[model samples]
Target chain A: MSAPEASVAVRQRRGSFGRLFVSELQLVFGRRRNQVGLVVLLGLVTMLGVALKVSQLRHPGARGGDIISAVAGNGIFLGFAGLTIEIALFLPLAVSVLAGDAIAGEANLGTLRYLLTSPVSRVRLLAVKACALGVGSLVGALVVALGGVLVGTALFGAGPLITLSGSRIGIGDGLLRLLLAVLYVTVGLAALGMIGLFVSTLTEQPIAATVATAMVSTLLWILDAVPQLDWLHPWLLVDRWSAFIDLLRDPIFTDRMVTGLWVDLAYGVVFFGAAWLRFRNKNITS
Target chain B: MTATRGAAGRRTLWLVAAGALAAAGITGLMARGAVADPTLPPLTPAELLAKVAAADVDGMSATFEQRSDLGLPTLPTSSLPDGEDLSSAIALLTGNHTVRVWVAAPDKAKVALVDGSTESAAIRNGNEVWLWSSEKQQAKHATLDPSAKPTPTATPMSPSEAITKFLDEIEPTTEVTTSGSGYVAGRAVYQLVLTPKDDASLVAQVRVSVDAQTFVPLGARVIADDGTDAISVAATSVDFTRPSDDVFAFAPPPGVEVTEMTKDSAPSGTEKPKGDAKEPTVHGTGWTAVAISPASTEKPDKELTTILESLPEVSGSWGHGRLLSTALVTAVVTDDGRVAIGAVTPERIYAALAER
Candidate 1:
């Protein structure tokens, strides 16, 4: 092919992928229901900033030890705890919303048959769709993280990202920590994508896929919270959600980090692979 | 451009959060006369460090209370860390974490570890802080900081006297006058609302009983502003003697990988305890020990009865324990300028100095 022809072909391929990804993004953020969650997170970050600033204006002598002790003992932390904790609790659901709709949404819409009939293979198409969803969700997660930091800094004077242990990092450092924490949270959230993708492949109905993935995440959270279930503690995907907390430590204690990351990765692999397999076997005639 | 001790910062945090502007009717917690709210002014970063370095403990002794509202992590109840981030970090969060503290001057303190699920903390020696899990009986030891070298031949002081001395350093700024009546550890007690002018100076309200029969910390609150309370211990065995030489040293168990630091070190990303911020009280490794008051004096004492009134006939708890040895005594004056002696155990011999 001549240069223009080749460039045109490349442009066409890129355009097709971009269109597919945009559609996925629109499906999630484009919905009115998802906007509620988005606003909620935004409010959480802003309020967290306000709360922290108020505390400083009121009582600046507090210590890190006091904060750390409180967090460890009570699972209470500073800043939009309601929202941060919520994010920790529900980010998975958000990921599932997008991922779970992947193949199933297409199938339910009757577009899966048309796409499968093209020159593209079903497995490749599913992989591409999954990738697009994961990236989109990851970007959303970053947005949420940025929202928290921005508001937290504005209200708290960007002094430092204070932790439950009373340790702090200056504004620059705080941002860095927030970034790291968000990244970890993102990875954790991504696992939801894998599950969502799996459900999407298993069910031909988008609603069923979304509901199943959400139920799975909720069950994991319940299992993690119901103490005395030592036997099941290590395996629950939600248990890893707390790994981000380690990032708050002065030194960022990580004996659990390694384990948590591994656990999350394992979940992603199993669910993602299962989804890929299911999609490969998905019959278009049905 | 200033750094305050983390521990000190925490105490300061308590003081600030206390919003401890002395209101009316508060007494015992503060001196009787109106003390002009004791200069309840906002402290700068510099003043905080100076105050930490200035803390003096003759022969200190008291069970401390450690509390943190979730903006920060676990820290000493009375003494906070000397890190830069401490104040700002804690100021941003609402942590409902309280711990009961027990400190036996110059050295022994038990911190109740708070571990989200169930809090537990045992003895802490130098860098090795011990914590027990509620579900498990076996204790786990983690290294924090390396034990500092023992202080060279140091000054002598009495336990109670040292405590009083500590009291001198932190003259009460807040006061509480109350009509309500109550009891603590079985003693008839009057309540007082104490707001601190200098937050870190308050361990708890020094409640003095209205009735001569009760020594209920003079209507003081046993808790800090954070709602963290100290483990109450009345001088069950009041002795003015120094403990044997080996009391302050630490000898760890074998086979444990003493990573020189807690295994969680590098991962902590915990910035190295940045610049050496001046600490309020710098305790050296030199042997500093004091005969503790009765382990438990069920009822509060109306007043601090000395050896004269400390006699069993006059007081219940002060008389029974061990002999008040004065000679092995290190004549240490308390913050109030009252003379105190550190004595050996109930076993060894010493000159007995009856309270002046």
Candidate 2:
């Protein structure tokens, strides 16, 4: 196609980006791996809730600051507990799967060329993929949180939330805080997705990209544990993922949470930029 | 096609540059403090000390952070059950703590020690005091003697209270000077530097910062002889506005276990005084003073014995013992069942242990 003709074609199909994003979502959710991953998450949450309930029945009155003990008192805590647990491993894995597949899966199947030949610009295609990845992370977080709420409230009725400040807050306010926690976690996972996207652009093998992305994330966590690396903790992407717990405080301490958001933004911008830089000018022989 | 490819490459490069800039900006912003060094009229150290003593405020609310890097190994608190007083107290010695304080003049106050998902609060309303712990889901209530009366010297719990205690120990062995002025919790503060004349003292200097106008202390830093901040406590944010009356009032939250106790029945000190151990004896004066106390008659627990054994053993004219030396303190456990501790060098501890 002539350059001028291609410009006209891109302008004409600009409105179809939303359709492209929807199709991308369909592709992500339609895959068997992602479907099973989500189902396993729900199953794990249910088992966790059941175990907490049983332990409470056995011990009767156990109390402490840890999440497991907190779960015995309020059902809402189950949501927090589930999210904390999944964020460590499962949710990141789910995000890595979709983001790692964003470009490489298409190329591996020899469909990237067909998609690029259409009226869509390479940059536009990446934007759509990023949006799809964002939605995928959100869904992964929501499954854990919603499942926790459903199972938790069912097992132990919801009422006033006892705050970290040892004060009582109404259920409405507690739910709002829980929602904020989910959103915060989604931001961290989306940042991880961006890293996966950058790694996805580096290779044509989807499995290799997924494994590398997951390893990069796990390595950040490991480095965070080493005392000598304290200087680098603030820069690590996974360092503040647990800052969501701050929302449960009486007046909510926003310092760490604010820093967490900034870190996520920085990672998202840089890694997404890297992915675009690598992918936009690549040969589409596959 | 080449032209389009070239344009795409340029756009991607620009995007990468923008991303890199954003990352650097965030890092720089995190490292930068909002307030710069504050300017204030000069005041001699003696005059500043007097100002701090006379200064008083009716009401205020603040969030403060305290970090004590004592070089002591942190005992794992998570595995221990909640309300294990010893573990919790030890945990406080080696980590960062954030506390929110609300005070209204002489009669009422509340302090909440907030951890990530748990809170422990002490609220004082009139003659009543309530201790609440969220993690343990427990609350303790006690009533103080109403006739005890509030003394004019009674200050609310703040950095000011702590600074006064440190200032009271000043003597000829200490040299005081005004270093400079800076900001604490966005308030202009005059810094008073206290240096110990005794070279044997582990503390090199103690810096106390007080609000320029009110003279209320906003922060304090204890610098070890090695020049490390052994204990740093500062107010991150503060407001002088009167806190709401309801803050001091405490009602046990739903689902928590509440215990009632008379003033006499309430727990006082953290450690019980052993029947065989005599009163602790103090030796020397001012900065290098050491307190020698009788060791507990009961045998040390397996864990404690192991920890004690891990310390380096020392022998001198003062006799043989295990030495525990931190940046700000040196401790000697003598074979004769005496424990001497002080913020002084091992030589001072030895002298104290050898003294009749």
Best by lDDT: 2
lDDT of 2 by residue, A178-271 (tens): 8999999999999999999999988889999999988988899999878656668879999889989888876677777888999999999999
> Could you tell me the C-alpha RMSD of candidate 1 in Å?
25.5
The DockQ of each candidate is 0.01, 0.60
> Every model's Cα RMSD, please?
25.5, 4.2
- Give the true-structure RMSD of model 2: 4.2
Could you tell me the TM-score of chain A in candidate 1? 0.77
Among the candidates, what TM-score does chain A have in each? Answer: 0.77, 0.94
DockQ of candidate 2 is 0.60
Ten-residue segment with the worst summed lDDT in candidate 1 chain A?
A: A67-76
- Per-residue lDDT tens digits for candidate 1, residues A1-286, read 8999999887886677666566656775677866776676566555555655565557664422333222212222333243355555456666766775678877888877876764444545766776766675666566666665455444433343444333344556655665676676777777777788888887888888888888888888888776446446756777756556556544344444555666666666667666665665467665
B1-356: candidate 2 lDDT, tens digit per residue? 89987887788678978897888778665554355787688998767877887888878988887878777665556544334665677777767788888899777998998766677888889888889877777789988888886576565655555555665667578988897688787688999998999999999999998989888898999999998999998887888888889777677877677888775565544446335447888999888999998766666566666777988999888788899999998998876767899999998898888776
Q: How does candidate 1 fare on TM-score?
A: 0.43
